[model samples]
Target: MTTNQLVEQIKQKKSFLCIGLDVDLNKIPQYLLKEADPIFAFNKAIIDATHHLCVAYKPNTAFYEAYGIKGWQALEKTINYINEKYPEIFTIADAKRGDIGNTSTMYAKAFFEDLAFDSVTVAPYMGKDSVEPFLAFSDKHTIMLALTSNAGAFDFQTKEIDGKEVYKHVLETSKSWKNAQNLMYVVGATKAEYLADIRNIIPDSFLLVPGVGAQGGNLQDVCKYGMNDNVGLLINSSRGIIYASNQDDFAQMAARKAEALQKEMALILG
Candidate 1:
């Protein structure tokens, strides 16, 4: 989807919430295993129950890749289902892929053409050549990893390069790339303090922020610094929402969790 389209959805829904479909079989309810395709079945239920409460859905590729072919199939089915049923909802393939130009092109094609995701998360370690291939795809977004919330982020992202943090360099340097307008970024909610500095670098670009509920990232703090005139944030809550309950009412409970967030977001927007 186009950036304008995504922004419109956020406005229409009164939310910028992005639900993470990071399904792990071990964590899902045991009853879903009886279905023909447990992964897809679980995803379908969750999507149907909560699609309206949020504006985006992100399925981390690791969850599907771990299960091998079946997992991949389920991932495809889940994306297709969302595209067919709710094309308005932005879809993200949380596959932090980065490689050589030729290889990155293939990865871009896999997610953008074959699977038809609206966006895909990408790593920036390989520099412009690795990321431009994905950015080249029209109407699709390449969300690069910037200041992540993980403990290891300090290992390099925050480390000073010359006089500036590596992530600051990444954000500033990325804007000069071809089709940079299509670029979004992954800024973990745990590092909400960094959002202000991040916005100063790229105030208009969207930010896909994970690490909210489960990781204890404060939503209010994220909005306080990260929000723009367009409300440029996709706050994701995975385990906190999807795993709200593992019982038969899992989908309902998930909706409740999503609704709570959406309500909070509505107040923020107002």
Candidate 2:
């Protein structure tokens, strides 16, 4: 989806919430295992239940890749179901992939053409050559990792490079790449304090922020500093919403969790 389309979805839904479909078989309800494809079954239920409460669904590729071929099939089915049923909802393949130029092109084709994801998360370590290939795809977004929420982010992201933080440098330098308008970023909600500085670098670029509920990132603080005129944030809540309950009523409970966040977003938008 284009940036305008995404912004419209946020306005229409009164939400910028992106639900993470990071399904863990062990954590899902035991009953789902009876289904032929438990992963897809679980995802379908959650998507059906909570589709309207949020604007996006991000399925981290690791969850499906871990299960091998069947896992991949499940991931395919889940993305297909969402595209067919809820085309309005943006889909993100959280596959933090990057490689040499030729290799990165294939990765872009895998997610954008074969899998049909609206966006894919990419690592920026390889610099312009690695990321430019993904950005070359028209209407498909390449969300580069910036300041992440994990404890290890301090190892490099925040460290000074040429008198500026590496993450800031990533933001500034990325803006000069070809088709940079299609570039978005991953900024963990846990580092909400840095958002003001982040915005100053790229105020209009959309930020896919994880680490909210489960990681204890304050939603209010994220909005306070990260929000722009277009409400440029996709606040994701994975375990906190999808795993709200592991019982038969799991989907309902997931909806409740999503609704609560959407309500909060509505208030923030107002």
TM-score, each model?
Answer: 0.99, 0.99
Cα misplacement distance, residue 215 of candidate 1 (Å)? 0.7
For each candidate, what is the lDDT? 0.96, 0.96
Which ranges in model 2 have alpha carbons more than 4 Å from their true place? none
Per-residue lDDT for 178-197 in model 1, tens only? Answer: 99999999999999999999
Model 2: weakest 10-residue lDDT segment is 1-10
lDDT tens string, model 2, 42-72? Answer: 9999999999999999999999999999999
Separate clash counts for every candidate: 0, 0
Q: How close is candidate 2 to the true structure, as a TM-score?
A: 0.99
Pairs in clash, predicted candidate 1: none
- Model 1, residue 155: displacement in angstroms? 0.5
What's the distance in Å from true for residue 124, model 2?
A: 0.6
